[model samples]
Target: MSLDLPDLRTDLETLAEAHGITGAVVAFAAGDEVAEAATGVLNSRTGHPATTGSLFQIGSVAKAWTATLVMQLVDEGRLDLDQSAQSVLPGLALPDPVTIRQLLAHTGGFEGDVFVDTGRGDDAIEKLVALLGEVPRLSPPGAVWSYNNAGYVVLGRVVEVLRGVPYNQALRTHLIGPLGLTRTATSADEAILYSTAVGHAGGEPVPTWSLMRSNDPAGSSLAMTARDLLTFARAHLSDGAGVLPARLARMMREPQVTLPDLGRPSRWGLGWELQEWAGGTVVGHDGSTPGQAAVLKLVPEAGVAAVLLTNGGDPDPLVAELVAPVLSRIAGVVPPAPPTPPDPPLPFVVERYAGRYVSDVMAWEVAGDDEGRLWVTVTPLGAMAAHGGSQTFELVRLRQDTFVFAQARGGVHSAVAFLGEGERARYLHTGRLNVRRSL
Candidate 1:
């Protein structure tokens, strides 16, 4: 089941141009053979053609790295999964009793997307954690599954506290450097030392390529090539070989919680999203920054892993369309098609879901459209609003309580579920739980 590298390079070039992707790198690994293809330019302004080694911001895909480090500590008897997060970092203030395992599984119930710029000091993660004292708790710990970036930041601080080093240093000393990921880096400054791709928004290069420095642990600041990412994935696929212990690596991919959103993968493990594809189970993570997107997928049964790194343009469909066919052809496994909403959507009371739901990072206003269809307008709040104003989507009912919103921007879809009675609905759960403001 060897991949035809020549054919893949041509296919990637065609796909990149068709999808409006300015630059992209796709890599596939099976057994010991790895094939990579790069398409388009690293930066449109420079017109430098992208190469196999070009680095792209891998985003939240780095969370798997953070999770791996935590598991390493757990294996060394320095951290306990069931221990309360306050026990590890006593200065932190969280409303619920969150455990280390909950943080990894994204069931910590805290407002997850707290992107506070706490300066470039070594105390950035500590300062970022302190700011969470003001954020409201979304639910009781381990009660629900929401994508929690802040939780990973907390894990980063835990790593620092136990290792007696900064988060980035700990990542390098314990994981990146040890694994020989020479092209992988933790900050924009480090990434500049390599052949890095400039991110793009609306077919134009982005002014800033990285997010706040404090977000390094949560996958906001890491950059690497698709091949390097697959190298990291290969460690897990090979059951941690030289890095993590075999048992710990296996435990990380075990489904820990059922994700409420029907649109996403059905379950989440420690840091990996678990999807039961038609061919078999595929586990991986996808990431997004300003204009960059990346995805890593591993088919354990097929002994195949794939990574896609792109700067600008929607990489979601591009990765989906490419990864499936390539994996199926090379590994003899077909990745499952993403779940689509019921055609001619089911009818539900539109007024029942009409209300304003608010969270620390964003707000959602659900209202009725002209034809009585339900639509939800999401407005970024506080510091985040200046970057992206607002977006509206028509909700297609998937069930009595669940609905899906297919955003036009990236053609990406997310699920939202309503809780509480008809008129007294108190919360709308999406990436995070947004509490209803008023009727």
Candidate 2:
């Protein structure tokens, strides 16, 4: 079978221009053949031309890398997945006894988006663990599936404890250097040495480079070129083997916890996301920073992997229009399409989903009108409000206890999945779990 490459540079330029994106890179690998291309500017103000080799923030995709390192320790008999995190990291306190495995699977059942800056000192992650003592626990450990950032932060601190070094250094020594990813950067100082893309949110270059350093393990400062990212993705292909043990690499793609039905990955693996797509299994993750976004999908059966990294704007349309076709042609793998509103929304009982769902930094106030239609008013709070303001959205029921944005916001059909039983839903799952205040 022959694999041909597309005109990726032209495709990216056209898509980036149409989507209001500052810049982007697209790269993929099938067997040993690889292709990559980039378009637009690194920063609008500087007018630097984006290149295939330029690094862009890879966001939570870094979580997969952190997870890989933890597995590496496991392979060496140095760490155990089921070991309680509090066992290794002595000053750590949690409402429930969380295990390393639960943290990896994001079933630790805590408010995972805690993003307090703990300074750039070597002890930043350690200080982060100290603060986790007071964070809100969404459920008993290992009881629920919530997308967790703080859990990875704690995992990063664990890596530091075991490796006897900061997370960044451990990445280089264990993974980056071994994988030969020369373009990957773990810090702003390192990123400056390469042609790196800065984020542009709302078509304007962001004032800051990356988020707080304390959350580095949860993908705050990691940046890399699309080619470099695909290089990392290649390591996880089912048949591929090298630095990581073949057994653990295969385990990372196995489903750990099922995700809520909200047009996201269907299940969570040890460190990666697993989705059943078009009769094939796709393993990967999506990530976003202040103004950048990235996605990776690998059809393990076909031995093919693809990634799209963007500086700003929604990549949904671009991904569906461009990236999907490439995977389909080689592997017959088409990503799940964005959910659409029913011609007439299935008749919904408003009281079931209507109420205030609150998280640490965001809220959704769902209410019903006299016409028996449902709507939502989203209020971004604290640091989230600083980046974007709140807006109202009409709700369209897609399924039982699940609703989608009536109007596509950012070219993506966003959604909310209300979980638990009874008339009043106990929690709202929107990528992250937001608890119901009125429950």
Candidate 3:
């Protein structure tokens, strides 16, 4: 499926404009062109136009870079994929049985936490380790996928241990320096240096506040420009020929977990996400922080890849929307559409989990329905999507009556556990919550 590059450029401009995008950078491999482009403004406040080299916070896309670093350690025999993270960073005392692979794949059942707000490097790592001591597990290690940031925080520490240098230094020496990606760096310190796009929240602009750099092995903090990201994408798509060995590169993209049930276009590789695009897999991941979002995709077979970064939380969808059309032109075959799953039955006992649950941050009201569905109201006029049966609904394990949010996609969020005859409970968004039912 060879693509018409000219058509793609036209569509991208139109789409970005429609979405109020300030800037965009695109990279492609079409016929003779291993090309890149940037459009719109880099800093709306300064009135500077974005260029092909303009930097944007690549957000968690940095995880792939970190993952590649781990792969290097693997190749050098300094790290074992199956060893416990606790072993790598001893005296930290993380739960036993959580392998390094679980951290990379986010299956360690480490409940997500707010440690990223604590600033960067050692401080952030210490905060995460403390949170790990308090957060309840969602499931036994390796049993579930919860998108744990704690996992990546630990990975950052792993990088430090294996290299005997600060994680940032190793990243610079091995990744950024070797790749000639001058604009990229993994410093929380720099979060205050640039004239970055200010983030907005609740329709109001958030100040130019910075994020605490995370030491979790799972990706939390890293920054880069559009061109540097494109360079990274191309390297992966090309199997790291120049920057990393072909064997290690292949390992990075290989599927470590089968996530076919995570819905259409969803799969998980070592640290890379695998999604079906026009019958081929577009391997990449999406990132989000308070004020940023980014996506990086690569088509291995076609030798084409794309990197899209947005300064604001609401990113222009054109980054992902362009993949299929571009890949079809390049690959000559439309990837198969994602499949749909049969709806499950509504649970019989939805009343037990009804009523309002308040937390420090927000409040929620869970109301029961006669139709056997449970709806959660986070606002007066709007709800958090419908959850219940024959179509969609929450499920309770009949044997234990534990609450698990299930859909055709299985349980993407951590289950809200019910314990001791359902008298008390806690709301775990990505893992089990510690708060018992107060009502």
Cα RMSD of all models vs. native, in order, equals: 1.8, 1.4, 6.8
Assess every candidate by TM-score: 0.95, 0.97, 0.76
- Sorting all predicted structures by lDDT, with the top scorer first, yields 2, 1, 3
Local distance difference test scores for all models = 0.85, 0.87, 0.60
Clashes of 3: 28
Collision pairs in model 1: none
lDDT of 2 at 405: 86
What are the per-model numbers of colliding residue pairs?
A: 0, 0, 28
- On a 0 to 100 scale, what is the lDDT of residue 2 in model 1? 63
lDDT (Cα, tens digit) per residue for candidate 2, span 1-439: 4567657778778988998888888888898888888888899888998888899998999999999889988988989989999889877888888999999999999889888898988888888889999888788887778999999999999999999999999999988998888899999999999999989888889888899899999999999988888888888884336667788888887888898888655888899888888769888889998789999989888888898988888888778878888888888887777888899669988888889999998998989999999888899886677757778889888987778888986677788898988778989888888889973
Q: Of the pair 1 and 3, which is ahead by TM-score?
A: 1
RMSD of 3: 6.8
Please identify model 1 stretches exceeding 4 Å from their true place.
339-343, 406-414, 420-424
**Worst ten in a row by lDDT for model 1:** 406-415
